[model samples]
Target: MQARKTIIRLFTTFLQFDSDKAIGWVTDGRLRRNIVNSQVYSSEIENSENFWVTYWYKQWQDNPKSLAKEHLLAYLQETCYWVASKTVKNIYSPQYTVSDCFQMMIARTDKVLKGFKPEMGFGLKNYGSAIFSSELKELLRQEQEIDICTNWRLLRKLTQKRLTESLENIGMNSKIIERYILAWKCYQMLYTPTQRTGTRKLQKPTLQTWEAIAELYNNQRLKQLPTNTPECSPEIIEKWMVASAKAVRAYFYPSHISLNVPHGNSEASRELIDDLPGDEEKSPISQIVIQEEKLAREVQQDRIKSVLLTALEELDEESRKIIQLYYGAELSQQQIAKKLEMKQYNISRRLSKSREVLLYKLAAYCKESLHISLNPPVLDYISTLMKEWLKLKFNPPTSEMEN
Candidate 1:
């Protein structure tokens, strides 16, 4: 009973420490090997009920400072990967590969682990798997929804493009083009063919649909004007729909007006006039400004590369390898884990830590050597730029690159 009390107390103490600092304590090479090499801990971990809870409690009791994050990370990696793989199969998109799923799982698991309660009498595997699966499903659902919306928008754009061309050919006014498009879309939504009957039905537009279309049009118009514009009324929208229907009917019927040299005298004519080629030569001042801006960007990129290279050199060999394998070699974390004989989650942690260290060192180098102090946002941008540069430099080119 005393041992049980001691174990509970130890578990509470482990929970008190910040996860990163606690993990860092066990991430030390010697400490990790010590924990892994322990015959008693190994035997208990494999055979015991509530393995992680019992193992962690034992570590805390034996040495309060000897918390092993590697064990926790290994369990997280295995469970997360399994859950991610299963989840990805359910997702229809080929783009959401096992690697992508695993990456997302690991990213979310970090935050989830911080909230883990070992004292709740559940093992980490069940708790962690539940969290992993929930997050993966949510992510996949969001991506699928986004894809559906994007495809719908693209189809709408194509329809609008063809409609716009037809309207312009008939010399329709530009100002009312969008209003006509919105009214037409509302009409289609209200009157599309019924799936079961496979027949087009004429349906009256609902007041709600008309109001929504007006609001959308008004919002779009408001963005273009410097001053506030009055919102369109439903009455005015109905009149516009009447006018659009008349114009569309006239468009289908052959008439002298339709053949009147395409009426090259309306707003559409002005648009065509604007699109006509002007002088090819740029003004000298504009040319010089463009050249100077390009040069400045090039110089900034070079400076960022130089600073990042210096920082990379300053990192320890292991951290450097993590960066190289990830950014430089483009290998996934699981692949790096196999190469290094470490847990996949450990590889993720190391890569993240290495990037943080590199950013810090880069900031320090800029302050001392370049006489410039970078804020967090700027440092983040520089780090992203450096990673992109490494990818471009190391990754094999696609067909576009070969061309």
Candidate 2:
């Protein structure tokens, strides 16, 4: 009760509203019910959450900076809080508190709202929670890379554009940036972690590895850079690599954006909103692809089931049991490990491996059978489709089981 009041108070202050008015507006029954009554079915009035969502969502679409949008986001703070609580428990990272995660989720309000569709048969909060979870998980995964990896691994993962930006951010000259990029490229090619090295904890390069990287950089420097440039020794290479890592780390640290600030001037805001999906006119190919995807979804559910079943059959007995226990029995990884007398980490890895198998099979089926191009969006679609199938297959609805 006290926590809710605190959030309400903060929301009021953040929006610069009178405390009494804020309370009244949030509690207003007529605004919640009457406005959406005509839009929703008669049956949905009893639970007016979706109605309120539809009400303010429409207003937000009409104007992103409107008070209606602010009110809508404020209303959904409880929903966002619920998600953040569960996320903190699951992720259990020392670096991120519940407040930190909640703020991050709030920062992504535009993205969450952009992905919601009333016609999709999901409530706004439900869809928003899923998006928030996925986005948060990806963010944490990136943070994990930064947290656990050595300088060499960090350098290896940095994209050319990122490395250039980091170097330029730190006031490095163009020529110096070019040299660092080439040196990092050579380092990436030579300093490979051993197979036993986990993805999360990449071992630092050995002296021999650094020497080899320096040798490679020396050999390639003249070809890539001016002949007058000095050849870099192992010590010089290590120093540059450390500097690059620090710069990349500083540049890529997460920064949360607040909702209170204006997005931009009207024209730029319009352009930003125009870039959202389904806002602008898509090309002919895009239209056909969208149509084909919709049609395929309607028809391909059963085909995907069969394809996934075949793929599951390919799994080893242990992997099969792990999937069954995790999905069918709906057990946590720790519980599954306890039951099977396996290590918890082993259980986690197997579960991931099982998903990878299913994902691969689903992608292949989409390409070979459905003839869908395996683009990122299409792959993501297939992955989601596969998960839905697995959930339904392993744990059918209670009504279906009874029937």
Candidate 3:
């Protein structure tokens, strides 16, 4: 009977039975006898409110040899299916499977459980849930960030291809072309890959930055060259480095490049098209042009609102709660601080920072996914419109007011 009840509990865990059902079965006299007989389950079930702890303990004990090698793999698999389920839904890419999340959760949970003690007075389920959920959220956040970085890498490759083709068309010298490519590589490395938003904050690359890149490049070339070959002079290397730095600075800043002054050829214009937003080609003069333009702008405003709502989901839970209370509930910063037991200044600062982060993310999304730029003025308009939309969404008009 004890063995039969133990089998039933194992099946219940595998099938993911609801807590009440599992608890009912676990607290039954027969199941309690099985749990009492299982020495590993006795300690965990002593003060537990639910059956999950005993079930998890049983699973862990049943696979003691596997546990010795893999630690929490069996235990987490029995206990944390919900963690994998939730993580899978949040991951932006389809490439990651639920099994991948499960493996990651097991690894993270093993590390966390190493520090856990029975005397801590917290149930394993509660502690494990908190740790696993937090780690899973961070993992999902990184996956989203990686998706953004991957898109930026593709953008860089496409830009490099276009620049190469354009320079070749102009009949540029091979050495100069190499210098230009080297300069572009230096420029790319000056900023970290993850922060390469279209409207990223720009800083002028210093001479030291160029020198470091040049030294690294020279060392790599020295490694590949045969010992019999004469090394390039310091003077020649310095000259190449200077030229590469100049080319990179020009490519990124382009302060001297004039978009307003029309270049004579199609190739010049095509080069500009990829770097600058293309000007809309003129269509036949029509009487409804003004109305069409107005309608288009309205459609764009609607899209911005939709995108803002989607971006809100990316914010952390605390930030999301503040946004909901302040924007959705129409609470002031002071009122929100009071309700949340935080400083008024902190509340105000969080709201300001959250808005800025959201706008930056929104701009990046528009540039990457929609092939549109969200300039300062456009972002300002969208921010105002989003607030108004949120008000309508959350604080609907009363029936009496509607009448």
| Candidate number achieving the greatest lDDT relative to the actual structure | 2
Q: Give one digit per residue, the lDDT tens place, for model 3 in 157-256.
A: 3356645654565567765666555545544665344454553333433456556656655555455544453434434544544444334333322222
Candidate 1 lDDT, 98-180, residue by residue in tens:
65665666656554555453432234655576667667777676545434432223223235665666577678877658656
Q: What TM-score, to 2 decimals, does candidate 1 have?
A: 0.32
TM-score of every candidate:
0.32, 0.47, 0.31
| lDDT-better candidate, 2 vs 3 | 2
**After superposing candidate 2, which stretches have Cα over 4 Å from the reference?**
2-72, 90-95, 157-181, 192-240, 255-330, 333-403
The residue pairs that clash in candidate 1, if any, are: none
Residue-pair clashes per prediction, in order, are 0, 0, 0
TM-score between model 2 and native: 0.47
Query: Which candidate would rank higher by lDDT, 1 or 3?
Result: 1
Off by over 4 Å in 3: 1-72, 86-100, 150-214, 217-403
lDDT of 3 at 247: 42
Q: lDDT for model 1, on a 0 to 1 scale? A: 0.50
As for candidate 3, its clashing pairs are none
Candidate rank order under TM-score = 2, 1, 3
